[model samples]
Target: MKRPITTLFMLMSIDGKITSGDSDELDSDKDWKTIVGVKEGIGQYYDLEQCTDLWSLNSGRVMEKVGMNDKAVAQFKSPVSFVIIDNKPHLNEKGILHLCSWLKQLVIVTTNKNHPAYAMNLDNLSILYQEKFDGEKLLDELASNYKVDRLTIQSGGSMNGYFLRHKCFDYLDIVIAPLLVGGKDTTSLIDGESITSSNQLHLLSSCRLIEAQTLENSFVRLRYEVLK
Candidate 1:
């Protein structure tokens, strides 16, 4: 498949937890900022994120958890073209409009026919209706049709798992926080169906460490090439 060079970019805990908890209310953006030891170096993650690929992918669940649904913003513009995968229609019409106004382009990949994005008739907004979610095909379409060269995967763990399982991920860039959040139900970096047989081991991806840099306040930046 012809697709863009994809990078899995994220900020995760030392224990690999993406969220502070499993619930929608618990998010790394909110919870980590409140903690003393973890909050000190948290700004570094956002600072680094500003330099990532202009084309970014995120799940609607992640945006909703970050309160984009109720977020009030002034009329502004951004260079980033955002791709949101939403099936539950997590974002409302207002939120979709907000994103459309802010981003260079807002592409919504959804299975929901009644998705709020479909109602709005905006030039920046494009709805890619899918009968079933296919991460690999999505990337190919983004590259072929949308002219996306480098795509940054900033979606939730479930979407990350889909990319990982499909071997759609090309690179991994992570800012590992100093703290360790331990919870069996908490969201991890890779969450989905686990391999039960030896034949399924091919789904596992091995990383070739490209660089490991230590940032201030105990935060670490790890970059890896997904060894294909």
Candidate 2:
């Protein structure tokens, strides 16, 4: 398959939990702001994220959680393009407009025919609708249509698992926080259906560690090359 080089990039806790808790009210972005130990190092994560791939892949739920729909006034222009997968139509029309204001390009991939992005006519916006979502096909489109050479995956845990299972992810860049937020139902770095049989053992993603750097305030930055 012809596709862009993809990297799974995220900031997670020591125990691999992506969110602070199961509830939307308790996300790492908000909860870590006031948390003592993790708070000090949170800036490092954002700083590193800003330096990642220009082609960013995210989820609508996370965007909504970050108040994407509430921001009416558009922000300053950015060179980075945002590719969001929103099957549930999580983002409203205003959110699509808000992204168009800041992003150099905004691509909305959805299974929903009534996505708010389809209603708009923006110069920077592109919509990709599919009856059934295909992880490999999405990467192919990003590489061919958008000319995205490198895509940074910042979506939810389920999306990460999709990429992993489909062999679409090439690298991993994770910043581990000092905290350890644990709950059986809480989201993690990779959350999806577990392999049911021994025949699927090869589906597990194994990687070779490229580097492990100890950042400030007990934060650790780990990079790995995913073995295909």
Candidate 3:
């Protein structure tokens, strides 16, 4: 099965943590604008005017944390479709449907075959399935059905770790912030359990740095290609 090229884009602290604390709130300091360069670099690297689809794991919480409420999401005018992975129906179906009616589409990827809300007819609501939420199969369906060639993954640690564990992503784009928040409960870019010697990601064999640059705000941007 053919799959769309996947890029995991994230902002991390100097110590490799995704969030400063246990909260999902992102670092919204003025210096955060440095992320624009990373977005531009992705567009240039992929030769895309704009990304085809925006993917998220538990995107509902992300939107809420980022100050985008149901009303705000409904007002979004971007052409890019939104794809969310919600194996347990963590998001509100009504809000998702409302947002989808105003956008290109809203796709919910779930393993639950008997989701009652999805069973009801909802306009512009697409439900894609996998028995156990296989990341590769979800990507294949996105490519085959939605024609998504370049998909951007904007997610927290758990989702990022899922793709990394499965080797589903192709590229990783990271923005290193200058701030450091040290906490044992803090989240990192990857949230899975510690890997043993056999399953560790060996940089030399698994990935290669393709781009590195300092942005105007003193943030460092790094891009790496996952070696296949």
Q: List residue ranges in candidate 2 displaced over 4 A.
A: none
Query: Candidate 1 on 1-228: residue-level lDDT in tens?
Result: 489999999999999999898689788999898899888989999999999999999999888988888866537799999999999989998788788878999999999999988778999899999999988889999999999999999988878988999999999999999988899988889898889999999999999999999999899999999999
Give per-residue CA lDDT, model 3, range 124-186, as digits (tens): 678877777678777888889988887888776777777777777888887776666678788
Clashes of each: 0, 0, 0
Using all chains and alpha carbons, the TM-scores for the candidates as numbered come to 0.98, 0.98, 0.76
Itemize residue pairs with steric clashes in candidate 2: none
Give lDDT per model, in order. 0.91, 0.90, 0.66
Instruction: Spell out the clash pairs found in candidate 1.
Output: none
- Candidate 3: stretches off by over 4 Å: 24-58, 67-73, 113-120, 199-205
lDDT (Cα, tens digit) per residue for candidate 2, span 12-46 = 99999999888877788888879998888799999
Better of 1 and 3 by lDDT: 1
- lDDT, model 2, position 168: 79
